[model samples]
Target: MITFGFITIHPNQENTYITEIARHSDSNTIVYRFIPTAIDPATEKVHGEKFNHESGVWETAVFDIPMYLYDRCFYGDDPLSIRSQPIMNWLKNRPYSTFIGLGLPNKWEIYNVLRSDEELAAYTPKTIKASSVPKIINKLIKDKKLLLKPKNGSQGKGIIGLMVTKGKVEALTHKNQKLITKSFLSKSEFSKWLDQLLSSRDYMCQQLLPLQDVDNHPFDIRILLQKNENGEWIEQGRGIRRGLKDHLISNINAGAEVLKYDDWVNALPVQQQALLTDGITTIINKVPKLLEREFLNLFELGIDIGFGIDGGVWILDINSKPGRKVILHSKEGKADELYKAPLQYSAYLEKQSLVKGVD
Candidate 1:
């Protein structure tokens, strides 16, 4: 039998999603289980939990580290990734064991890699490590408006948008389903704010691109791509994320609304829509290939793209283990694909492993 281990960040819950994979899995041929990040390497086992579909509850059990694993763990925060490092090393080092989607990559690492690609570089905005407050001052001077992104942030948290000129700076973020605003009237004031803001974390600075829509709602396109049963990257779906009125961030979990992809596209002017679609289609076709080549062994990507007020399209962010917002709002029956993707890909991995005799 083929053993497929699925690892995630949190512990047992009514994990209906994981259960969906289990329900559809091939019986007698494949045995799969879910494990938490709090694993013990000494025993080479996890307090593996299985979803009891019949009971509709998570059932706990112990499991040995399998030869094949679907690593769905979204590693963030140095301490947790550090804690999981030994286990990661153990699984990756083994000649017989294979892991799909090895682990998440750092945003800084991704930026540096993607920027090296000429095609990709054209759409990516100028980004640099926010190493010092003075350097941030220089970037503000150059771009006039800037965005500060937490290097390891997820779900639109800790993202700060700043609009600057000679005098005042407006800093924006999404908080508690509301827009959080802070103001600084001078470079020294902004610099002082940065000193306190960035003291505890590493951040990347980027030029804030124009995204003012007809109604002035900050909006963007979120396209989620994933590998299929045949190991080909394909667009799962694309949806529009419209921010609350005048808000900076448009993350759905952070209180933004999901808009259907076609509806939003059709609403735009003919010229702008054509321009936006052309650039986005090209990006969707290329980014997955480039990232897989550069990083190697990835199953899915969540690409965030948006257009400037002037009809220029740009990539806003890239996520390895993307959220389900886009899929959730997609056409009828499309949401079914999201749960099936990991399982289908895992089956592919099993076939590949067997063909190579697990070495």
Candidate 2:
């Protein structure tokens, strides 16, 4: 029987999704979940949780690292994350094991790649490393608005909106699910605040896009794409994520509301709908292929797309280890498919490896 492993930073992380995946595994395959730190380097065994099919529960067990791995580790500035980085690197380099997706680089690196593609360049935003506080302040002064995003951030964390209004620089961010606004009277004060923010982590600056809805709430289209059993990329689902009024981000974690994709699109005028469809089609068709060509093979992608007030389509973010909340909310009856996807893909990989005599 083939073995599949789900690796996360914490044992409880993504418990629901992991449970569902294990429940869906066929008799020919087994599912296990573990943290990188759980591996015993000397013994080459992992002391982790294994799913018991009969009882439908996860039990503590010790076993060798699974041949196929699903990496769900999200790192932060925490010590655990720092320690796990090297362990994950070691696992990735192991000849006997493989990750379902190798994952993508930081946001700035991804931006540099997408912008270089002629077709993707038009949709890519102008981004620069937040290396100079003075330069960022100058741009905010000139353009009146800019967005500061952590280079490695996800779930709409560490995003700040900077705007110069009425002779004051205002910084807007969400904290504890509440909107927090702070104003600076002088460029020196604003620059000092920005410097402090940048000191903790790397950041990127981009000219703010008009991604707000008619109600002035920020919104974006989130599309989930995954490779099927045949190892071909396909769109699994898409949805509209609407943020709180006057917010900087539309992440679900930041109190965003999920809307059905068809509900949003069908309400638009026929001509506008046609245009939007064509634009979305062009992006979904080209992005997966382009990214795989530029980087390593990936199993899935969560693409965040935005439509500016100027009627321009833009690529907001691309996540290799994507969450399924948007898909589950948007598409009814997709629970089974989503749960079984990893297992099916793992089976395919096992077949390929057997044919090539890798194992």
Candidate 3:
């Protein structure tokens, strides 16, 4: 019997997708416990939400530490908060309890690691931590355009695109519910804006690439990769996320629409399509192994790749606790594969635990 414990920020047992994972997990020996990050250590149990498979409704239930804990907690800016910190510490000390996707990694950390690796360096874009206006200006002068994103940002939040021309500096960012475009002709004004943004959060500067369709709608491929029952990395599926015309990043949450993957690739020239698939396959073969060595116990990853008009492919992002927007937007069969992945991977972990006792 393998008991899977899912930990998230909130207890929303009614979430159909959440239940779908548990529902598919129903079996004589398989059980599930949905836990929130706010844990009470004195009780040695957490305030968890468990699905009542028979009743078809989730009810309040106190749960002890299960065989494996899955970290699905979405900590926006601060991955480790006071509330979730204790839970993480406790899990670290628990000998019998194991965790999958233990913690979210920083973007800059990933870039630095990949930058140092010989094989991955060729695939990594030039990325660096933005500390001052001088550094930003230098990148703009060299690259002409720059993209600034928070190191810990997720779902395309806090992304800014800057284009430098002769006498003007135009900045673009998504705010509230719409895209905002601001122009700074004065050097003083632009520097002030840069200072404020840098102080607010840690940012990374990357040389912006031209990643848009012929109609100027920015788009990218979101690849959903997961570890299967055999504990091997597999490409579950892929989806195309197209942003509004002129929008910088192709984040599905940021007004991006899902397009059929096959349709998008088919529209491209036959030779370009071949290059696209070959580049993606190269990424899939290399990224997972490097990441597993850098971190540990990762069950899945959502890789965002950008393709330029010149038939160039670049890795845009790597997410440990990846969002399901890509898979959910995929075909019905792909959605089923996404839901089944968690349970399947947990069983694999359970088998590994039996072979080598959890430390």
Candidate 4:
């Protein structure tokens, strides 16, 4: 018998999509779930329930297995929601226990992996941390327009763009509103804003890359890569997400919609198509390799790339555990195949157990 534990950030009610995937697996094996339930853990064993779809009931079953370990497998953002600290410790001490997408690489590590100025062209916007405010201000003067962002931000939450010329700076909120040049005109006001933002969390200043859009809505591509049993990276899914029109960020959580990347790429001018594919391929290959070298345990990554207005490609961001919502949307509910990577990998790991048993 094999022991597998499926967990997530939210409860099963909010994550029906993930539950459906687990329910569809082969029935020859016993699957234990650690989701929160009304049953008592001290009296009722945790690993004895079987899901019944007709009544939406999970009933306890009889089973005794020698292997005692859990796989923190999940499809949602909160995979480590229940007793994570204890679960992590248990997996570390037990033999043959492993986790996927546990913790992601930091922002600085990602930037060092896929930043290519020549390939990015106008899309390779200059960026700096709030700690380097002095240096960033100098660059803002030269570039005339700059974007400020939070260090650990996602979904375009905390970003501000500033326009500058001849020591005069104009501020624009996330909505891209034009100011009257009075409240945020001088360097002192800029310093004040920087101080407040920095006091809470670190921030970065970047040159505004003119990202391409569909129907005036800026869009970015998220390429899903996975390593098979042979340990080769294969492109599993690709889709473009159109952000709320004129917004500084293109994250779907912040009012964005998913589209097919091929649809947009095929419509581009012929002369630029080759350059786009080559650039995307180069980043897709090298970025993952760099992360592998730096963060060896990271097996899967979601690389976000977008095109500048002039057809130049730029790496917008890299998410270690990006939600599968967009990928699910791309396949139009035909995602059972792509969603099987974790299960297939689990089977491969089980083979190791079988080989050792035979020996």
> Candidate 4: where is the Cα deviation over 4 Å?
32-96, 115-126, 165-183, 214-216, 353-359
lDDT by residue (tens digit), candidate 1, 37-113: 55675775677765554565557777667656776665566576666656666677778677767655778988877
Lowest lDDT 10-residue stretch of candidate 2: 270-279
lDDT per residue as tens, model 3, 25-98: 75643445554464666776766666777887667777777777777766643544546756666775688778
Q: lDDT per prediction?
A: 0.77, 0.91, 0.79, 0.61
Residue 161 displacement (Å), model 3: 0.7
**What global local distance difference test value does model 3 have?**
0.79
Residue pairs in clash, model 1: none
Clashing pairs for predicted structure model 3, backbone only: none
TM-score of the candidate numbered 2? Answer: 0.98
Measured with C-alpha atoms, the lDDT of residue 82 in candidate 2 is 90
The better candidate by TM-score, 1 or 3, is 3
Off by over 4 Å in 1: 29-38, 52-57, 75-82
Of 2 and 3, the candidate ranking higher by TM-score: 2
Q: For every model shown, what is its TM-score relative to the native structure?
A: 0.90, 0.98, 0.92, 0.76
Which scores higher on lDDT, 3 or 4? 3
Per-residue lDDT of 1-359 in model 4, one digit per residue for the tens?
A: 44544543334533454455456556544444554332243543444445554555656654332132223333222434444545444544546445543445456545544454344333344556657667777877787877777666565666777777555676656534222232366688787776766677767767877785656667888888876655467777888888776666677766778887777779888877887888788878777666676665554678888787787788777776666767777756547765556556556667766789999
